[model samples]
Target: MAEMIVLKGLIKRFGDLLAVDDISLDVKRGEVLGFLGPNGAGKSTTMKMIAGFLTPTAGTATVCGHEVTEQPVEVKKRIGYLPEGAPTYGDMTPATFLDFIAEIRGFTGTERTKRVDAVVETVDIKEVLCQRIETLSKGFKRRVGLAQSMLHDPEVLILDEPTDGLDPNQKHHVRNLIRDMAANKAIIISTHILEEVEAVCSRAVVIGHGRLLADGTAEDLMARLPYHNAVAVRVTQDNLSIVQEGLSALGPVEAVAEAGGLTRLRVAADDGKARLADVAGLIQDKGLAVREVFVERGRMDDAFRDITKGETMESLHQGDGNA
Candidate 1:
């Protein structure tokens, strides 16, 4: 539960533009922090400052107790960074590229060979080990980049779009690898993919205009959506009104929409909290033959859209957690 990475009022400005407006956050060991934002939202910029790739315009960033600006080399030695696009030396084969990384990380002789072999196997890039990085497919290239970042087995990991070029299976593979490694490391993953937040991250941070908009667990963010835990009842066309009116009587109905010849009803909670069981009784009492009934837990994309549109966290139903 130790804090591995901490940002205190971090700020990054590019000439006239304040790319990363004063923002602060923390990533603790044994936690996977999903860093999310829209394009040009300063996600990559902030991460760069933390990784020592760019100097911050203001504020401070620390990795494992070492200040990024003051002890950049020490910070670099304790963390693994995979930048956006997973850039690598295209001319070198995976074997050579990883070996070079191992050496740079201070591995030597047998230790260097062991680390390279372990990473190559871990990323499952043996098939392309001897292939030039440019000759390898995008997915393979990304795997190579991942291998290099993990070669040193650092305590903190800063991955910017780690699964950018991967397909569904490949993405799943990488996600599983991250989960396996999460117990002992503090990981910061900057990505546009929402599912990755749900899949691997223990907590998510949403930023916009370089300011911290929302910070909490995935469920906390989802609870901001109006449809959080809303139930959907699909009844026959003839019974649409009956179902709608019956459900509305039970609680406030948000909307009733038709799709695929079935009516989907969204019931709302008056106190900004969803009550699922109340709707179930209405369906039974009405004796309406329902084709389908589903409970929506919540959707991250919906919350993201709302947050980025200048909707403050305070505006969301505050009973649900918000930061």
Candidate 2:
């Protein structure tokens, strides 16, 4: 696939703070790449650089082959950006705001009118088109923002927290819009919602503290973390120490907990399918009544927590000169 967006050794700094470290990444044409990171992890900084809103202190970025710094206007022309808060002209109606954006994007005359109307309808904001943006609900306002970003029909879209304040129905609608747009445009969605990543993004890149941590498909990322095939077993019992000890005797157990008359154990092994059967067999042989045994599949949330927690702990230790 062709690369629509590329960052080479990208770096951004604010005095003593390095907002974005040297990072290189690529977004393929017609692909939705989820950019995920904890707060202050440089996700927004990276997106800003890509959108030509901020110049990288060092390194370079390209949008549709145009260097973001050297040809910012050209890059901006080919890309649509929706910032973190989805800011809009509060005083202007959806129709007015979109028309303003269309003018700035160089749309004119009948072309501009048609484009504005198309986007307003595409976002399903017809009823709220004439209402002041401030009067519209958060969800409707977000739709207006989305419509403006897409008015020019840019080939690349950079959306930061696109569904931040949207309701469930609106979120679903926006997700569908993004998926539909991915057929013809390269999109980068920066959000903390793990389920959204799984739902809309074909690939994901995880960042932490101004550095890239992991990049791959959801399944691939889950496999990279330890305990990918582990399973959690819960048994109804007052005391889990004995049960934990018994389970540990079989193989390596990751965790054990007992609360509210339920004992939970996480077992780790090379073959999860076989390990589950072994565990059940052992529990039966030991004459313990097993309440439930189920495989626990690794989720994106678990992987994100592990990566960010490790990064946080490492950063603290580094500051303390411990590592």
Most accurate candidate by lDDT: 1
Candidate 2's displacement at residue 287, Å, is: 8.4
Task: Note the residue pairs that clash in candidate 2.
Answer: none
lDDT of 2 by residue, 145-176 (tens): 88888899899999998998999888888999
List the lowest-lDDT window of 10 residues for candidate 2.
314-323
Q: What is candidate 2's local distance difference test score? A: 0.83
Quality of model 1 by C-alpha lDDT: 0.87
- The runs of at least 3 residues in candidate 2 whose Cα sits more than 4 Å from the true structure, single-residue gaps closed, are 238-250, 269-288, 311-323
> For candidate 1, what is the TM-score?
0.95
Cα lDDT of model 1 by residue, 1-323, tens digit: 39999999999988999999988888899999998889999999999999999999999999999999899999999999999999999999999999999999999999999999999899999888998999989999999999988999999999999999999999999999999999999999988899999999999988888988888888878877788877777777887777777877866665555767776778765455666677777677767677887888777888888888776555753543434
Q: Distance (Å) between predicted and true CA of 303, model 2?
A: 2.4
Winning candidate number (TM-score): 1
Model 1 clashing residue pairs (backbone): none
